[model samples]
Target: MSLFQLQFIHRHRIVRLDDVPPQRTLLEVLREDLQACDAKEGCNEGDCGACTVVIGEPRDDGIHYKAINGCIRMAHSVHGMAIWTAQDLTQADGTPHPVQAALRDHHATQCGFCTPGFAMSLFALYQNKVCPQQAITPETAQHYLSGNLCRCTGYRPLVDAACSLNDSPVVTPDDVTLRTQLSKIEPRGLSNDNPYLQPHTLAQLLHLRRIYPQAQLIAGGTDVGLWVTKQHKQWLRIIDVTQVRELQNIDTQTTHVRIGAAVTLEQAWATLACERPELKRFWHRFAGLPVRNSGTLGGNIANGSPIGDSMPLLIALHADVVLAREEAGQVVERTMPLEHLYTGYRQNCLLQGEVLAYIDVPRPSANEWLRVYKISKRQEDDISAVCLAIQLKRDAQGVVLDASIGVGGVAATPVRAHQTQACLQGFAWDEARVKVAQQQLQQEFTPVSDMRASASYRSQVLVNLLQRAWYESQDMRCITLETLA
Candidate 1:
């Protein structure tokens, strides 16, 4: 098959590139090639959202606009989509957009380095607002603006601007034109006989994996982007799976929710939160909006980071991961418990040429009670010092029928607290049983000390977290450190 030209709509015109490097990020292309410097490169990684841009694609309803970090997104991934930067929001006559005007009216700019990214993020939210809606609250604005950070401490005015957007007339995109333009550019399979290969289907992906077994598989490039920015290590070849339609599916089964490997964290959490509303708070803390918008659930699990918040929660829920590989001109699929998938620190059971296909999470039963807790230095957009997830079932007498406890950042990999779970099973749901389980949890793993917390502190926190879970399981109000003081 011949290599197809990378085509995308930028600033209302089609831009085509044939010789773009595979490793080139969208941020580099915007600043260096297109001279669209409004999307500033703050950290050169996805952490700082100064490189935020809104990408619109044709959906069933209309154009779906999403705010993503341009620093980690590959230049080729935007093919067949409409790319919008902060500069694109201005009218042809040079009038400021509604979001830009609102920010200016609310005095949301200081130093002005982060304003463009913030405006673009707000632009996406503004464009996608549902009809017959109430006014956007400050809390809602804060949630949407969480990804874009400003060093000048200018959040109050920015949040005010976000809330006041609804007061003005809603500006709708040219959906008919955008959808028509996007449909013209078919989803191209990109391969330049180079290391970067983006296959449009699962068959092509597995075939390419067989051809390039050593190529690094990247979904959203959230963690891989850090390697290039911080470690300065260049990957010889990269297979981007984000383009594979089969791996981007979210299927609702009668007994389980099957989430594709390439499904972004934002989409997976939205579906998961519907059945398990307890995870709503935990989902928000998974990362800032931009990271969640770009990062994939499968990428997070396959990275096998000990502190990865998703694994522990999934482990507690008894999720299974599906692994796939092409063999004898057919696809071979294998499903295993998510806990057993991880072997050690940043390690997994995936064999060479095999790829994670989907994560099958069982729907919560009516009797099941689930809770997840994350202890971090910062409340938003920070790695967990220690994360805990507990799933419990009780009988009519309040006797523990079953228990699953998963812990992270205190073990080589996210691990199930087998001893603690065993200790809690068949015990009465009372303070005495929780105390014994807490003791078992402390002795289950010898956590290493690091910058986040000391080994002793992690051990103690495990015990306290168990107690807190017990308090929460009952009707009693739990006292946290902040409230105690």
Candidate 2:
């Protein structure tokens, strides 16, 4: 147990490494040590799909396959899981798997570098269809495939392959043995000579944080992984919170949803979208599937990125964040509005040794209307130039009783538009009142000019989005630029 065992299935067999470096990415391990070069590293960040790989872990029903970016994922993160790569898709007789066959029959490759990533993504989609007995439509295939990019401009054939993958059912080999092996690797603490600590429980995590206050806490490594690969920052101590069972729970009550700090964006969005179907677009646009699968809501909020989409939506929903720390051998928790968590750019109110524990989001009331709008350069898998979320409650006569508006990418931190909210509240829900509120929104903050958008443009877009929300609230068809063009 002291050897820092890294256990996972590769090539249909259990692969264990006991001496892995603390920050080695899965792509590096795959190409360097194992010589499994199918998962290529194109961007070295999580943007490109060339490093896509499917991770399978035991769930209540069966194995759950998730496609993730290998380049930004720590090699040790996949412990007690099964990893499926492009090379593992072939049959024992050396014939191409159905996904590969569909791609081959459809001519889905040009440079052949991105094919492996595309194939693995398609494999996940195919498995997703079979496990849930869901049909794969062209739109579904396209939505799942957004994370991957084809520099050769070869996407039509790949989309065709995805849509036709259902023509042949995917038959996975019996993984009963694999599940048994994974089950035996009980959740024990792991630490290497480099002071990389993986604690299994909340108490252990808080104790470790108190002991090593300087140790960087990592959830999914979606952001911290960049510190190693992109920024080249070497850390002496690291505390990985992904294995903490208490931090991964999702509790839904009668009036609210309590999401653990370590809950992935994919899981949080899934639960939230179930209650609010309008979040489907924002969820998909949050990031590509791989990044969402690896990134956490807590990490996003704690990172304090102004353009981070989750903060605005959560703030608009009047979410509360639970911050915890160890004091005198007992865990102390404090809850506050999510908006108050941030103090400034890339800064938060978290004290030393303190950690974000949970996010509590209240369910929208019957008269409440919630809407989130993210305006980005690309339609998918891109950062928002301007993100806006508005939660408005009206009386039976259509008079606004209460309003909360959150705006991002226009300030040092994601902020609530108090001026705009005040203007909307107690006002009639009409075009004139919306116009006045739009003016208030534009004058509320002094947005900076960045590559994503100019200050004037961000302000204009923020006001325009408010207008769009008003139109939607009134059930009036508002023509968009796309519709006009």
Candidate 3:
């Protein structure tokens, strides 16, 4: 097959490069190919904000510019998008942008290695928040900047710079023209023998999956990018499934919310949090904003990581997944409870040529009370050492009607705490019953020790999580991150 190039708008200039590899990082194209060197590669993972850049995707609402770690984002995945780096903020006359001026005035830059990433993140905040005339509170600023890290200088000055975005005159690029150009942007064509395939429709994606069953599938590339940068693995062929139209819809029905497979975690989290507001804190702790914007809920569940935060939450809510495959030139689909999908550590029961299509999350009922907890080293952008999600329905008399518990970081797979649920089923929703069930919850799984925590620590945290839920049920204030808000 012939080789293809990437075409997109870098800053205000249209850029086209020849024969770039499909799995190449956007950071590679920015620094090596286009020579837009403002974004520096720091962690080479999504954790550090050093390689942050804003990519504008034209949506039905408007152009949504989100901060993403260019070091982990796929180059070809940004076929015809608009990318803005730190250097793109300055004008021809050398007048600094509001974000740059804020950082400089606040003395947020020290050593300057992470400055570009911080500046780009602030630039995104300015565009999405200040430019749109929305409020950028200190809490909002801190939440948006959670993905960025600066070892030399502390976050006080960075927070100051972020909170200061609205004070200055908002001088942003003309997005009207950019949105029009984005509407005209087309998906990059595939070469005859190309290892990279971009499919725009579900039929095309399903047929391609049937033809190339061995092909690796990538939506956000958050996990697969680590395989390349960290583990140094290479793929011969990859099917890009982000463009599938059917896999991007989120339908809010009467009793359930059907989230498409390719829906970004940010969108899904926002939708789910609206249904159950108690999950807002836990959802924000999943990862940094860039990871949330790029990664998908379906991708997280499909990966079947034992420590993934989403699985336990879904299992507790009694969610189901829809898997689709092209069989004998026909499209076939099947749905199963989410807890039954996992087979082993990082393994799932998805059949060959099948792809996860949608996740049906049930809405909370009137008598339902749910609580989720994540015990991690850091409150933000950190993996859970022990994660717990419990949903129980109770009558007005405080009798436990039904109970479902989902837990992670304490088992080979995200297991449902069936024994504990049974213990709590007919019991009164009181401290005595919860105390007894907490002991059963610990015995439900024998956790393994890793760098995050010891086996004993994982086992003990479950008891405390349940205790906190007990306190929350009684409407008493506890030590929670939400109080900070």
Candidate 4:
């Protein structure tokens, strides 16, 4: 198929387009071409959920409804899937959807700017949770609505609207027809003439990587979208990683979990957090549900954002990355520690034609005590000034045996604190030793001053966080923001 040609299901009907730009975003198509302004363009970046939309990905089991930022979603990425905009929620007979009714009855919307996005996010949650009779709590509602921002409404009404779904039940339209139609779509490859290349298999992906050496690879578009929307940059070619088949699997083994490159952060973090119960809070703090649903964990690692939350946690977990390429009709794979993947700021050692295929994360041992801290201005839906993940093992006599420390937002790339780890090793795991090591931790990195934080503040927070970890290690109660939540 021609790369410019696009086809998908919209509002229970098939839609097709020709000569669509290779990098045209879904929001641009909806607002500019179709005049569907329900998904408004606010930030254009993924942060503000004003352009939230629910996409239905048809799987063998059923249709997986995901809420994603439409502003940043490339139109080519949604070629085979079904899209649900906020305007499509009304029933055929003009009956408002239960979600819409609940929001109206509760007066959850004020100024009406963010209401559609909230409704779309709630629609995704309703289809996934309400259809299966899952109990939806206020926490669940809050989690789903994290991406949405309302300047007027205090959010109590919105939370109440989400929580009230089960109280007043309504019938959901049957999706058997939609399901049958979408499931029949056989995956197709974009033409070589196509600037946006989507390959279904890892081998094909690698082959295309070699052919299009200058083509930027995009998985979730969380990072690349910003360059287009904010920086106003355009690329002649883009290689989409989401369609690659083997890159979407998550295989759990006896000791560790292998996450594919296209696995969304929501699914990947949940799977990884299953083994480590302590990771639940940390993973939830990664982003709002919509961003998490669309963004991929492997993409985050491949992005090598110095302030990325996953790298520090993965580095502490002793994760390894499998870089692969197609050679002689066979896959050539090389494994390296996750921290070693990045060489400098926003730079990775991935050679041309070599793509990051899998991330192998080892499970934490029983002897290890893991502590993850994200210091940001806001409690949630914010970027981190300093993200720290510490894992320690100590002897029965309370002497430190080994230590693993990974930190972000203080280095050019996500880095492991080798000197800090060494300082903590072979010493008594107590207040006095922790105090001594705190100075070393602060001196390990020269953090640059930015809008988020000053270099001095980042250093002092590292020391304070280490002290907090020590205080808790001694069985003393240390109150955290999450503890209050």
Candidate 5:
């Protein structure tokens, strides 16, 4: 079991980075070793699109593909997945992909550093859609490449490249060929004799956890990789859980939908979107497509950030988190509410030698109406200053029967406004009811002051969110009355 270098499955090619060091970005490996320097390092913190690349991860249904930042991604993070850089899309005869063709015809290149990233990101969009696709529209293109940033060229031409919407030559690489080349290399860990740990079963993971209790359990590196790159810290022993088949499952029964801890945010959102269309806005706003594709639901909950975007929805829906620990050579399970899992700021209740196994969200009733809103300084790719999730259940009389208000950025952890919900339980959907509930919420929370927003500002926005939720739930009509202060 290696701790650092990875044998990543890319397009079925086993890309073994045995000599690659831990904390080295994918951009570094591509440029230095592979000499495929198309993906450039812009803002090494993942803010720039110059290092954008599409990743194809194995899913229960099939393969899931999306774009991601290569500059900030750890080389070990691409294990058990397919990585498609801009260079990979070109034909053996040097013919470019359709996205590259469109970028050339449309004159999308300026400094050329960002072009490869843009091309790869757009190629992912092209792969996601149907073959012989229709011309991509401006709005659709913007949505696809929203994560990438272009500083040199004005974004007009680049946007046009994304809009071309033409399919590339139907070229799919043979995974067997890639894996065969990868198999010859030796597995290398991050620390001395601790390469990349790929676990095929729970027993192996438990055994490894006991041996390396301090090891970082990495499912998605979106949050953890930043600890190394931005914070500049090396995690010696890392257990890569991406290869475990059991942890990648999405099981749905009559009572609940159990999303495996390894399930990416994109997968969770896609599943939720199919069942509830109202969640589409939250899913898109959760993060950029690249981040959503790479970040996992379990990782988000386990990170235990007070302002984490995923916690409110899970809390509001009464989701449960399953924790697995090694006990007497057998894996033991303990389920806790998602809210209870977090203890304080960046703190969780997880024990040593324990890992989150799954997130269980109970099915909502037919009459249940659930909505989530994230209030941030910027609409997309920004952390929430005040996030709100409201789940309402109406009775026969159309009055509010049961309601749950789970909010982040207003407390130490993602918390429920129990008093506010109590205020609305038997109340009718009206201005007076909303007014009372709004007043109750003010008493329930004393939000911390931060650089993103002030305590007063967060409080005010939360009140507005409650009122707006009421307005939307009741009807399209809204009436305001002036009152003397």
Candidate 6:
């Protein structure tokens, strides 16, 4: 039984590219399948910049766009979106767009393998030309391009190339008629009319779960797609949750913000940016624009990576995970704290038949201050050596009302330092209080040593991050990289 056919929808229209296999990666499709060879495959696992491409997706709030590593993205993943490669940046008259023109004028290209990836990454920035809601400063420019590695041209010229695209016209169909030409490509075919469950409603999703109990449930394929592309493994039976409409909504009522499991990080961040501007900074550094565009809050939560950055913040915010399962032909939903959602390393409490449906974060009061900090070897596009998120509330008299601290990269799962939180409660937050809290963090966990950082370094960074949180809560200005030199 065929539940539905998989189609690669691009720019509000389906792209029908002939001779491409269903499980092929977007990088391979751009390079080999579609013959658009600019997006190279430097590191097949999404580390290098050679395979960068900007995908244009129509989001509910706005046009959600980001530069994703084409090397790891599956062809079917580009459905219902418009993809722009570096090859699309020039005008019909053969004039280069500002981003390309700037790169050329600045002599940004060296080996040129990384150039196309950088061009596409910058092109994504160029398309969204207006000043971002969170200003794209030099720090952010570095963060955005961190996932793309260039061995030559030192990165200054590339960064300059990005900054110069600020005045360029938007890269949309209106500007270049790019969509009309892109629509000419043919669609890739899925394996043998095999049933692909696309549940649009909560009731339907559950019903299908029972119907296909053995079907593999998929959300964002940041992790699972590797099973196909990198691992060369295929799921004979799989049900993608991306098409489930109910699971993709982000609802904010008077008391809480409910983010559906299928909601992309791009969507969730925008929703949270209004309420928590501080979170915008972490969201920018969460992943490159592309990974953020497709990766989801639910998927990240369900992934159960101990070093994952999002879980620590969600844990600190007292967020809840909602799980949906099929029971005797009916859909049942259950809710629990985000921390309890995991069991151990590479393991989660989720049932075999259940899918994470949504996450709910209680709205913070006006006096409550929340901050999240990720300490990694690199500023962006890297896993955390120690991920810390803190939520603090104080009364008018400067007495601590309540406090919650969550730390990752220190244990089997993202965990809250309840004991540390207890030590800070009711204590006057002076230098003395900071010292005690910092010392308590050292006692919180014995972080495992890894290549990104040593256990001692991770421990120290956690303490430093908490102290920084203390200052940030006070709106105190501190020295940053820009101020150092």
TM-score for model 3?
Answer: 0.97
Candidate order (TM-score)? 4, 3, 2, 1, 5, 6
lDDT of each: 0.87, 0.87, 0.88, 0.88, 0.77, 0.75
The 10-residue segment of model 2 with minimum total lDDT is: 186-195
TM-scores for all candidates? 0.95, 0.96, 0.97, 0.97, 0.89, 0.85
- Put down candidate 3 lDDT per residue, 1-485, tens digits, no spaces: 13556778886767778787777999999999888888998999899889999998887877889998899888988877999999998977899988989999999988989899888888888888998799888888877887888989578999998988879887866778987777665566655477788888888888888888888899998898888789877777788888899999999899899999899999999999998999988888899988988999989998888899999999999999999999888889999999999999988898988899999999889998998998999887899999999999988888999999999999898889999999899889999999999999989899999999999999999999999999999998996676865
TM-score preference between candidates 2 and 4, better one: 4
| Candidate 6 lDDT by residue in tens digits, 279-387 | 8778877887667766788888888899998899888889999999888777788999999988889688877678789999988789878888777777657778889
Better candidate by TM-score, 1 or 3:
3
- Cα lDDT tens digits for candidate 2, 150-258: 9999999999988888777667656687688678765545543535677888998998888788888888888888888999887777888887889999999888999
Q: Give the local distance difference test score of model 1.
A: 0.87
Q: Can you write out model 5's per-residue Cα lDDT over 1-485, one digit (the tens) per residue? A: 33444666543356666656766777787788778778887777666777888876544444556898887677776755567888787766888767778889888888777788788878887866634355667767877786777777468987776766554455544444544454554443334366457676777777787778887777668887788777887866668776666778899989899998888888888887778788887787787767776778888888888899889988888889999989998889999888888778888888888888889998878888987888888776778999999998888786888888899999888988889989988878678888999998987899989998999999999999888787778566544221110
How does residue 316 of candidate 6 score in lDDT? Answer: 88
Q: What's model 6's overall lDDT?
A: 0.75
Instruction: Assess the local accuracy of residue 166 in candidate 6 as a C-alpha lDDT between 0 and 100.
Output: 61
Winner on TM-score between 3 and 5 is: 3
The alpha-carbon lDDT assigned to residue 443 of candidate 3 equals 91
Clashes of each: 0, 0, 1, 0, 18, 11
C-alpha RMSD in Å of predicted model 5 compared with the true structure: 4.5
